[model samples]
Target: APLMEIDPRSPVPKYAQLREILLDWIEESRLGVDDAVPSERELGLTYGLSRMTVRQTLDQLVDEGKLYRVPGKGTFVARPKIEMSLRLASFTEDMRARGFEPGSQDLARRVAPASGHLARVLGVAPGDPIHHLERLRTADGEPMAVERSNIPLALAPELDRHSLAGRSLYRLLEQEYNLLLDSGEQTIEAGLCDATDAKHLGLTAGSAVLLLQRRSYANGTCVELAISTYRADRYQLHSTLDARR
Candidate 1:
């Protein structure tokens, strides 16, 4: 344990000052996740503070979900939460804007016939050839989401050759093929992750995840169908709803 000094003349209360010091230590990785912290009595003696003050600080941290306490054991640092923004933006752009080193792992890519549901969504005949691409998206070396996309084969035949793992699909469509994405409609739902999804997303099986289905159109023609799953704990969907006139 390093020497911790509390400024008696500081404007902040003693308990809050102690809590901030502990939090800074955790954030700086001086105290790692699940690492046991000093007990209230020990911390009090070390800082020359009352046991009640140390306990108060610890209790506040626990309430804020930054620490966990066990009856017989002691308090331990909690894992940090990943923050996600709810906005209308491309995944590639979003990851880059956040200063995260983003990359994608291509799972599969093949030209296959569209099924009934896919055909209906794409406004094409059943069994029409469509290009399917599946990828796992990562940010800052962490698994973020799994994206599966379907595109009309005739529209973007060279999509299979392009390396999509580290770039934006939307940019590829516009830059490589001169296709313009006019607009898109998206739907969101909550569901538990399946085995393959869990493995790729680095989440425990049956953990809650957000399922997003989107159909994008270009030049008044249906162009893409995308299905994505995002970790629920690290994401929240946001939209502004306006009342009807």
Candidate 2:
């Protein structure tokens, strides 16, 4: 079905009207994941609205992670969301428990000095040598999240030799490095995907994403600080809170 016309005289904003129509189409399966959305000019012409209005509407949808755009190509629909639990476990372990095949594409692996933020999290002095690993994690070949982790070089020197791509980082830490992660703290917040993130996550620039910052510890020593951004539409963090009787 084609997009519905926006009543020019209505009080509802034109951009908002477009948003609702697009959402309805998606909900009704008129538009499926990876479907090519109409261009701004086409949509504007069809709705009798200005091109600026259409651009604003499409931009908002992209920001909400409802759409994705490829450079030199057209905008497309995003993939369905994947639920992520708040339980403490390795990425591979968590995915396995959820019946999803976990894999990763290592983006970068190098030894660098800890930044100010990383130094605080890892309890290392700023400028101290640290091993950095950047990866795009996936489940059954579908992109899930982009993760960047920093570890003190003194603790995991052999980390550079391991093949992290398509493997579990936590499992490698335990079996190969003889380290056990006892506990960790995490913070979650909403964030917009930048150009680099959008490219890796297959989203439009400025798309809404969930940012997670975590610090893992072993024997009361902070061992790693990881920053991850998960696609908002593909992930929801769930927890069950209880009241003491």
lDDT leader: 2
Candidate 1 residues lying further than 4 Å off, grouped into runs, are 1-88, 239-245
Off by over 4 Å in 2: 1-80
State every prediction's TM-score relative to the real structure: 0.68, 0.70
* Candidate 1 residue lDDT tens string, 1-245: 66568988989899998998898788778899999999888888877789989989998988666887877988998766555555446787788897878788899999999999999999999999999989898888788899999999888977889888677888998898777888788888999999999999977799889899888888888889999998875666555799999
Q: Candidate 1, which ten residues in sequence have the lowest lDDT sum? A: 80-89
Candidate 1 clash total? Answer: 1
**All predictions: root-mean-square deviation over Cα?**
6.9, 5.1
Distance from true position, residue 166, model 1, in Å?
A: 1.4
Candidate 2 Cα RMSD after full superposition onto the native fold (Å): 5.1
- What is residue 148's positional error in candidate 2, in angstroms? 0.2
